[model samples]
Target chain A: MLFDYVYAVDMAHTAEHGARKAGTRKRADAERNIAAIITAAADSLARDPDASMTDIAKAAGLGRVTLYAHFPSREDLLRSVLAQTIAESTGIIEAVSPDEGQAAEAFARMIRSCWPLLSRFGSLHAAAQRALPAGEVRRRHDQPMAYVERIIARGRAEGAFRTDLPVEWLVTTVYTLLHAAADEAAAGRLATDAAGEILEKTLLAALKPE
Target chain B: MLFDYVYAVDMAHTAEHGARKAGTRKRADAERNIAAIITAAADSLARDPDASMTDIAKAAGLGRVTLYAHFPSREDLLRSVLAQTIAESTGIIEAVSPDEGQAAEAFARMIRSCWPLLSRFGSLHAAAQRALPAGEVRRRHDQPMAYVERIIARGRAEGAFRTDLPVEWLVTTVYTLLHAAADEAAAGRLATDAAGEILEKTLLAALKPE
Candidate 1:
């Protein structure tokens, strides 16, 4: 019903605006619908990794036809949502100085700044892993992971982090710990307020030289 | 075809053993069938957490009817598989002396002994979490987790492990690390041959006193 009303308004505006203006207006409306669908999908998928397309469409206040017209397929929709989420998190990570001061301190600063991204989008990560190929999922994570990898490499080079373990293993361990912290907080087993502090302390302890 | 042959042989045995003995014989056959299904389900689930009942039935060499008779639902089958896996691991964990030597050494022993359990049954864990309630899944882990908790408590008391972090969080962190090691090994990022050694080193490093 809501979509029908929007469609009626769009037709009336198309008649009033003429061909060129109406073409631009239609394009803008289509872009708005796509944004709404992506936003709704991210929220829906975060809440339930297996949320249905119909449910997401309803949440977006658009019909299934409109949603499909934009996404074409579930994979396309998931990829877009993941890209959007990564873009948002990249903005947060950029604000933290990964090269400033001691490597360990930089790691702490990065974790404190970006921990919420893990907590907020953990479910979305799970969803993408289920729908996308392993390589595809890993590739999407490459950019964000590179930020941590640099800090870990600097830590190792400076002898601030343990050299006994492989740097790749250490990077994987940090990510696994962050994901675990998010799971614990979501399960109510750990206090959300203290999760970041706990995570930073634990990761620093684990990464320090023997 | 194989099950049909087995059915025919069983019918012949029923007649040969007579009514009284056949009842006992039939019970034994049922038990054997149940064991086969559980074994097949574990292997199938470990390979693919989403393995269907039909696939499990084919793998067990029994019909879907027989499989369903034994396990009316996927949850029932998953619970039985999880329980059996835990029982096997419990036997392994029992052999390790959690009280002998330094707490850190004892932890190494326990992790060394039970690390395979985490690696082997990781997929089944994912399956159970999907099929069962969160509390139900956690309850199934109580026995295995209690052993680790006791060791962590002793370590904290003896000042072998760090006391700065909450015991609960530390226990969870150890588990998260183990699971991550298994995942890395499975992905070929971490060598299976060195996983236990690496796991022991990283976990001991994280748990040691500052």
Candidate 2:
């Protein structure tokens, strides 16, 4: 009777351990699926704003059931994709050493690194605008600008940028011009590199002291 | 009997003339309603993108039925508003003398004249994007840029604007900046006059020779 009780206890312990492992594995699988879905959605939606959920599921190489399990609706998925895009953009901006070089060069580097993101997600932006409320969209778009704001402030303080215009307006000016260049590039009127180059030159010129 | 026949003919003629006059009045009334609806819609939509058709009808002092008669749906009304806005903007751009003064001064005049259009229609643009196809929105938005294009070309040829950048890029830069200024003004971060002045100064600095 004593041996049987010990055996029963051990069995219970093993079962609990197995269940915990399975739970962890399930959670990890979910994480992977979510990342894959977001990435695939970004690509698919970027290429075609009207991409269906089934299309995204196929692109992600996951079953429709799994996709639905992760994202219950298209808006939820778009929100996640936008979140990821913002995260990636923030990461990119963070990696640039804004204080390491001339503010102009730092600004140029920032523009060059970020323009491809705009080009890649051009159509996705339209879809996001449709799916999301304007204020929400504006908030997410503003996330990456914080980094830009810092750089501009640094430049202005160092006399590397003009002080004639308000820094806030200047930051918005950069934001607007970058978006316009992305639009031009997405339209195939200008290559991505050419657009980046033009932005850098025009902005640098605009930022210099009059 | 002849007198009776002449009286009957005159009665018929009078009735026909009255009907013709009533028809002309009805047509004139319809034209007036359409103009009022479009104008009122522009004002309401520019203030609020989610302005309802009923709200617009009330603003225009017309019945809901009349508003529906003229605009079958909210999207139809938005289309008319956008069209009217574009027409007014084109008229504003046309009045700017892009060749009368030095290219720089003409460019400044163009910026000052057109900035208010953007400021007034800021929210209307958001509504247009939501209702219209992206391509259609883009095409309509590009309508007013033609005049800006001509001014930039003139500036470049006259050596007033930089020749290093492409004329098209320069034109778009001006457009993007003007829209940015409008956005800032709409957000209450910058006054309309201050935004215009900053745009003029910054853009002029950028357009000058390197």
DockQ of each candidate, alpha-carbon based = 0.36, 0.56
Quality of candidate 2's docking, in CAPRI categories? medium
Give me candidate 1's TM-score against the actual structure: 0.81
Q: Runs in model 2 with CA error above 4 Å?
A: A1-26, A49-58, A61-69, B1-15
Output the chain A TM-score of model 2.
Answer: 0.87
Task: Report the lDDT tens digits of candidate 2 across residue range B1-210.
Answer: 999999999999999999999999999999999999998998887777677888899999999999999999988888888888888888887798665777788878877887788788767777777677655765776767877777777888888889988877887787667756765676677887677778899889878888
All models: lDDT? 0.82, 0.82
Model 1 Cα displacement at B165 (Å)? 1.6
Q: What share of the true interface contacts does candidate 1 keep?
A: 0.57
Which whole-number lDDT from 0 to 100 does residue A196 have in model 1? 90
Clashes found in each candidate (C-alpha, N, C closer than 3 A): 0, 0
Model 2: lDDT to the true structure: 0.82
